[model samples]
Target chain A: MNEKTVAVLKQAFKEFYFKNAEKIITPIRMKEREFGYMSFDKVMVRHLSFQTEGDLRAFLIKEMPHSVYYSCAYYYEPTFAMDEKGWKGADLIFDIDADDIPTRCKEEHDHWICKDCNFMDKGKRPDKCPKCEGMRIDEKNWVCPLCLKATKDEAIKLMDFLLKDFGITKENIEVYFSGGRGYHVTVERSALEELDQLARSEISDYVSGIGLNLESLGISKRASYEKMQRMLPLANDSGWRGRIAKFFSEMEFECYNSNDVKDKMIYIYRKMKHKNFENFVGEVIGKLSTKIDAMVTTDIHRIFRLPNTLHGSTGMLKRRCDDLLSFDPFIDAVALGEEPMQIFVDHSPKFTLMGKIFGPYKSERVKLPLMAAVYLIGKGLAEVD
Target chain B: MGIEFGLEDLAKYPFMKEAGDYVKKLSLRVEDLGQEDYRPAVERAKQRVMEAIQKNYISIEISEPIVELLSFPLALMLVKAMNVEYIIHRYSLAEAIRAESLLKEEKKSIISYIFKSTFNLEPISVKHELFDLKIKLIEYLKRATHFHEPEWKLINRVVDNGFVYLKTHELVRLIREEIRRTIYDRMKGVSLPSMPKNLKEAVHEISRVLPPRSDKFQRVTPDKFPPCIIYTLDLIKKGQNLSHYGRFLLTTYLLSIGKSVDDIIDIYPRSPDFNERMTRYQVEHIAGMRGGRRRYKVPSCRTLATHGLCFKDKILCAKIRSPFQFGKKPLFKKKSTGQIRE
Candidate 1:
């Protein structure tokens, strides 16, 4: 980590424990932190012993890397007077406090990351590097974005990587941004209670078993789903108003069924103050295809009503079939790419809106044709035959 | 949406079909009135027409054929009401008779001289063109009639059809015109001027046949009568409103605003109200007068004039002319050197 990053971590821990640990001590012999040994190549650790926490802290700074460390919570147990084993099962527990060790252990060698796909290399963000002529370095996951070459996917997994892999229990899994370029998944302080003490090592092992690769997180499912959008048809006898009410509540309106739809629509349109209704409401409804899986009523009137058309006012009741294509809902999913998207479900119009002007039998009363045109236009769907 | 609902609802009304059938029958009768018959017709023709109009809009109106047959009577009434024979003769001759002596006037703008020269000799009742206009007006009125009786029934049937219906204004016009013609003829043969001074005296002998109301108006002033109603009637002939009610309203308004009743009676003027109903209508609307004037309900005279008049219908009210457009004309002045100036 850079100096500022180190300062942040130092301040976070020191602010809480600074007053309590004035004369903290460690065992005179180099105390064993953990007995398990790694049989793999390239494993080394620096060790030192101290009488005071200050001395140990100095030693940690002098030896450890600036970033990248893991903590294992384990301690020796004590027993109460057994016959032969004495204090084995019956021994008082003794724990070595890890407060003195820095979070990172610095490596002696320099690190490099790929310029394109994050293939990391050691010995400086290299010039004309072997894997990639595009110069860059990585101390973590190494995939070269500039060159086709890639390192083993298991280059280096941060605590965040582990969290993502195991999908932290809902309580601990708050998503946030890392300082730059990627997201940080913080297993919250509350997670301390949720982690199973007996299977602490198993939890870490389970995270590794997820088979996450650094190079080719091949074809993210989110990306491909955008390519398959469709128009959501109007559903009959559906309780969609409740859903719309919830959205209004989210927007902080506390709207009710009695509230005038036209008034609300007029308010929204005025707030947007955009010359083009298409661009304005498109923003709010566009994100909603996935989350709510339906468009809001506020979207329809403020935009697609198109009152100033050449003919005259057109009204819609239960969605009109002819209106489908004009409102081309099946555009790119969330507009991230060229993948189409549609409302997973359709919504209907309120009946009170259309008037009861009597006309020539069914010809006048049942103006379904107008309704179809209205729906298609409102949704921005491509007109269909 | 336009007429479908209206048509259906009308069709279902109990008497509508009967009314429609009767209207059609009455229309046939009116057409037959003129052809192959002179005087004899189904008895109570006017009553039949009224009932037919009550049932349906088309049958009540005088058919075109009926108007042709009845033209002489209609035309006679119109000429008498207008007093056009004397007026036209004087007006036409006054311009071209520059010689001051009748025989010495030279023929200038020959048609004008012919009119000026022949005007006195031409029988007031027999001018073919004027008679033709009268006949045309009668035909127009006939077109407005219903196939059945009563004006309303006629309106119900032929509202948007291509028939040329008369407005209240036009009805008012026809009334005045008919009165003018009738008065003109009544004066003929019954009385003669024998060199009466002031055209009014010459016309007076003829105007005696006028309706009592018209006569009362003519007596309002020595030389002036209420020309307002008469003038309004003249206006509606060429420029008319859509309904007869509108015509009545406008003419009454003109009478209220224009000449005195004595002035109108001094001319050929009459109405049933004229002989016995000449009561004064007084109003006080000044603020703080008569016990603090709390009676805000009392409308202005102009507004009061609107009440009980034929044009009470809002749609008909559209024809009511602004008071400003109905005021008197400026009298022509004679310039020096014996020349008439406008």
Candidate 2:
């Protein structure tokens, strides 16, 4: 971003923080959490400890950083260096980002440009550039309603795993719209806080269905068709067995004791266009498993974006969702003002903000609401006019 | 209500808190254990360590409760005094196994008492068709994390209302794991005063019979290892936690390069959660000596990248497709030097 765009974003962020300083919810054990922020220039300032919510609010009002973060982990001395800080424990957190989730809308909004050859293309970014075979590929990702809805669905699936499978109560689970293209589900002050990296990895694997063995669920490739039908897990069984069984039932194959029904189900499974039992199992796993960022959940020392702060990328508030089913990020997470502002748009796809649709403009100067202008500028698609 | 356990229970589970209370009531010091009155205890302690090392199981004989109870601590001291890592792990496992076998015959009340006193877990008894006991989910996870089987994953089990339902045998198995950890912790890092003459001789005798550490990996070239293997080895050497895939990569890479199972097992002692039996089973399974009887091949660089274990070198890694090809000389290289020329 240029200096002019940075100044505008800084001013808007400053206004938001100043007006809403008191609205920031204090994290549990605030004094034990490390605070950090990134300046508009992208210089990260970390190892900062605040004694109270008032101190944190005062710092925010003075600095008004582009983005703010607090550690998921609690520490004996929050300001100490990484290795020196005595780690108490961390809240179990899961991140479901639109970037990680594969959505059909990405082909319309996401594009990648190879830095080596300057070759640009739409759709998912290739592992390496086709023209130059270079690894430096810059991707431009825009979150559409479809992408956001996909991410929200993933977050809901993750919440299901946390609640029914892990047995975490609804009151202990807090879901938040991450203010930019994702959702964060945090389990706070629970018995899971003391889990180490390996344990947390196992939990991640369970939710994501990594390393799931078919034999454990009584679905074996080598079993005879009769035995396989007989050994199929019932829909009321526990855990993955029940999940897979329910998935099959939803596909119109009920696990009843009738010979005709069993024969029909086996016949359908066998005639799945050369997809063997393994492929069928794989399909079930893919559809039933929750897509979670395993790396973020397993990292105990990671710092998360603070709630109620403006995301630097979109200028949206990272606010909690009291009712996830009805929560709309574009409508509810908009914290910036509607004052008219003029900006020169280089190129941007059509998007919605605060329930109003804004254009797919080429190189043109247009007057827009403050929220839309700040969002476009923050995304590096616009500059101050 | 506090359940009362008798001398038989204390002698069988000498690591229990009640055993400590019994020993405290007797008020026997280190010096007194060396005296003639405690000769049988000293002898039994030597036998305990010897059985653990040579046979991998310590037999319980509660004919003499005092001797049995006293021998437990004496054996711990002897293992600590020897201060050998292999012996420490073996002895802890043997003692835990001994406790597990004895707990199998005890009633529910006794088993629950041991659970409460030793592991600080209060698993409530649940009347269910498949499961008889249910533990708090957190308590279950803390113990179950050590298990590598898919069945032990929390998602595979029956969990309801923050309690994990478990079979009696499964509960016993979890207790055995905790007992092993507790025994290992108790045996580690304690300096004992000079032992009695006979006890010192026993330690010396046991040391003579201890198996020599495997040195087969000395023939393998460490300098030629790929970056990912080198990184995993570094983590293992530093006693850090390695991911499952990281362990698999290191094991398969070593096995592919003709490292013996014993040599591979020796490499893992520095890991924080090393279990000799588990390591040996997994290593042998990979070597095609167990389960499925198909020797696994080293994963390709693409597979490594998918699992996020690839730590590729820009120049060297780009040349090889698989980690097995990492250190080998190029096929077209001349026989004189046998090295890839820049």
Candidate 3:
């Protein structure tokens, strides 16, 4: 970003932090957590510790950083180097992002530009530039209602797993809108807090259904329909067996007998070719499993975006969602004002914000709401007029 | 504390916490073992260590309860004085095996007491259709993470309301792991006092009988490769269409053991649809030279099993976590220079 855009974003963020410093809630065990932030100049300053919520608020009011983060882990010495710090435990966190989930709306709103050849196109970015064969491809992803809805569904699926399979109580789970195209579910003060990285990886795999085997559920490839019906997992079975059996029941197959849900599913499976059966199994797994960022859950020392803090890319607050179904990120997470400001839009996709639609602009100067102007300016798609 | 075991029970499983309390109550100093009165206990201690190293199982000969109780601590002291890593591991395993056998006949309350007082684990007795005892999920995970079998995975187990249901034998196995770790930890970091003449002679004899440490990691040749790698290599050489995971396994295994990118590329020419550019790019990527700049490691033995690629040689692959760990000892007798040949 240019100096002007940075200055504009910094000023807006400073004013917001100065007025709403109390809205940023203090995390549990503030003294034992590591705090970090990215300055306006993009230099990350980390390994910082705060003793109280007052200290954290004072630091935010003074520094006015572009983004703020806190560690997921608790350490004995929060300000020490990575290896020197005694790691006590970490909260089990999962990040369900719209970027990882596939939605058809991305083809309409997302685009990629090759830095080397100046070629721009829509849809997902390829690994290498098709025109220039260069590796420097810059992608511009814009969130839409469809993509955001996909992420919310994934978050719901994840919570279902946590509640049913892992048996974590609802009160221990906190869901947050990431201020930019994602949801982060954190499990705190639970039995999962002290799980090491390997065990956490297993939990991630279980929720995501990474290594699920049909044979483990007694669904063998060579078994006949009659044999499979006899050996099929019942709907009352626990864990994945129960889950797969319930999925089979909900699949709505034409049944000759009403009580034979297993028989109907087996009849369909017996008719499917070997390749089709694999695809059918894949579809079942896709519906049952969550699409969580495995790396985030597996990383013990990762820093996450602080709640109620502005995300630099979108100028929105990472707001906590009490009811995930009714929470709308574009409205609830908007932290900037509605004062009008003029900005020269280089290029941007049409987007919705706070119940208003903005233009798909091209090199035009327009007076937009301060929140939209800041968002466009932060994304490097607009400049101060 | 209300539940008490007899002296015979204490002697049979001397690593129990109550046995430790009994030994502390005796107040026997190290010098007391050198006297003629404690000669039988001292000799029994030496025999304990020797049996652990030679037979991998200590046969219980508890003719005298006091002597048996005293010998357990003495044996621990002797092991700690030697302070060799291999001996500590073997002795701990042997002791844990003995405890497992004795625990098989104990009552539920007794097993639960040992679980709490010894390992600090809380296993609640429950009446379930398939299981008798249930431990908290986190407690189960703390020990089960070291296990590589698919059945041991938390996803495959019977868990409800954060408790994992386990059978009596399974619970005994977890206790065995805890006992092994406790014994191993107790046998470390000891500064021995001046030994008596007879004790010194026992130490010298034990040292003479100690097995030589094997240097299995020294030679990295194709003949020493694990069965999975060898199977993948055979498939590649036979011009069979290998899966993506098979190719990844072969390439990473060869690259990790210091094989050059070009040499690995040469092994892939037998594939019917060989493309030099694509192969080079993939090899370079896995080797950490291109894209992400992070070298890929060979997946663990459990991962291989999940992927259905593990052609397990039960004896050769025993206790090995990764493909690189296989053939740590030579698979066959051979006489050649320890060098990688193309």
Best by TM-score: 2
Candidate 1 vs candidate 2, TM-score winner: 2
How would you class the docking of model 1?
incorrect
**Interface RMSD values, listed in order for every candidate:** 43.3, 2.2, 2.0
Candidate 3 backbone overlaps, count: 0
Model 3 interface RMSD, in angstroms?
Answer: 2.0
lDDT of 3 at B291: 47
Better of 1 and 3 by DockQ: 3
Give the candidate number with the greatest DockQ: 2
Ranking of all candidate structures by their lDDT, best first: 2, 3, 1
Candidate 1, residues A246-347: lDDT per residue as tens digits? Answer: 333345333434344333433443454434433533443322211110111111111111010111111111111122222211110001111122211122
Deviating ranges (above 4 Å) for candidate 3: A214-233, A252-283, B29-44, B60-67, B189-191, B194-198, B215-342
lDDT for each residue of candidate 2 in B218-300, tens digit (9 for 90 to 100): 44578889999999999998999988888888999999877888668878988988886678768888888754678888899
Better of 1 and 3 by TM-score: 3
Give one digit per residue, the lDDT tens place, for model 3 in A93-169.
99999999999999988999999998999999999898889999999988887898999999999888888777899
Ranking by DockQ: 2, 3, 1
The residue-level lDDT of candidate 2 at B102 comes to: 85
Q: For each candidate in the order shown, give its overall lDDT on alpha carbons.
A: 0.26, 0.84, 0.84
